[model samples]
Target: MTDYSKELEIAKQAAQKGSEIIRNYTSNQNFNIELKGKNDLVTDADLETEKVILTHIRNVFPEDQIMAEESAGERRVPEARTWLVDPIDGTTNFAHGFPIYCVSVAMWEHGEPKVGVVLEVGRDQLFTAQKGRGARLNGSLIHISRITDPADSLIGTGFPYRDLHMVEHYLDLFEYLMHNTHGVRRPGSAAYDLCCVAAGYFDGFYEYSLNAWDVAAASLIIQEAGGEISDWEGDDNWLFGKRILAGNKVIHDFLLNAVEEHFTPEERKAEK
Candidate 1:
């Protein structure tokens, strides 16, 4: 039997601690915040959360690699296992007190996501998943939405803020989805959005310019919940390919074809 109880326990513990820290700082009127990019913002909560979570993980598995959004450096050890963390996803939302952010913890073994936990701090909802086992939301089994028709599906997407240069192209894709799908919602938190997908709240989700921490845990949750994910090229480069498309099998295929029809591989390469 595949037992990931230890990994899940550590992830939940760290995530809970991070959530507590985030909640404590959310009400602070005067907190340190910085701009990491044009629209990217980082706050003291992020740093502190990552510190606590990292410290806890390192204490148990000192030699394992830990790669967090706030901290990039990793401990390169044998086994090539890495813990991916997003202390606070949807920082923009969190800073604005929009209650749309979450803490994500995931461990990738040999570059494959094996375990994941996304804690929606605001709502105290925990979405967890283990490879080949299944996905759960607050201990209840969850699955992706079965909406196959794009026009009848509630699709999720994120606008291009960091790389405005791709805004026009992204807008084109957005326009297509907006017109073709029932409707689109951009929750500003990719991690949380993936959980939404896993819970059948959203039928499909696509975005660009995302980091590993933002999608690592959520992606695995989606997969374990019987969803499909890939890049614009319909490949497995979602981690760093700067693009991601995820949905049920049929919707995933539809989205991939739509992307292929919008931009050719040559056009994409030219832009790069």
Candidate 2:
């Protein structure tokens, strides 16, 4: 197997660089924030941090493509060696002075995530993973939670902010989870939410209207940590498909079954 330690190192540095920018802006409270859409936010910190990350990657691997959330906007992930960067994964939380934001960086080779890193800026926690290597949190190996029953599971999720038309369907699922699960939390950052899954904090996570950059890095981390990730259809289309349900082995299957029963094909298509 090809070793991705070098790529993983680069990813960590890139994430740290982006995290520094996020911290600087957050501390100074000087970033210009704007709404990308309803309840969707972007900030100058996001743009500047993305530029810094893209430049850092180019300096080490100039031939690789880059898909940054701010710059790539509605573009498709290229079918090549590419760096996916989400400079600030929780802009709304960050802008509101909440400490749950993070910087996520991942390297993908031909649609496969090779290396992933997420820096939880507030607590200075680092989550890293390579394709074949096990996942880590601050250099210690981590694994997914073994909780199987929804009645005992603590789930994580993101609300459908961009499309209110899908709210009723989402709420239907949410209501079921609320009644069945131990509790549900929306942490405002999908990257961190997935990292929480990899670290075993959240037993599972499901959401719609997520983008490539939001889940790219964390998806690999989840897999390396011995979890599973897929779209609502329980397929590999989660990266670009906008709907994702992720968890450990048993919970993944449980969540997939729940997703299938609650969501319709028409709703999934409309998200795309």
All models: lDDT?
0.87, 0.89
Candidate 2 regions exceeding 4 Å error are 269-272
Q: Write the per-residue lDDT of candidate 1 for residues 151-256, one digit (tens) a residue.
A: 8999888887887766766678888987898888998999999889899999988887888889989999999999999888888878766788899998888888
Per-residue lDDT over 75-141 for candidate 2, one digit per residue giving the tens place of the 0 to 100 score:
5666688888999998899999996999999988876899999999999999999988899999999
Best model number under lDDT:
2
- Lowest lDDT sum, 10 consecutive residues, model 1, at 263-272
Give candidate 1 misplaced runs (Cα > 4 Å): 74-79, 264-272
lDDT, model 1, position 272: 24
* Each prediction's TM-score versus the true structure: 0.94, 0.96
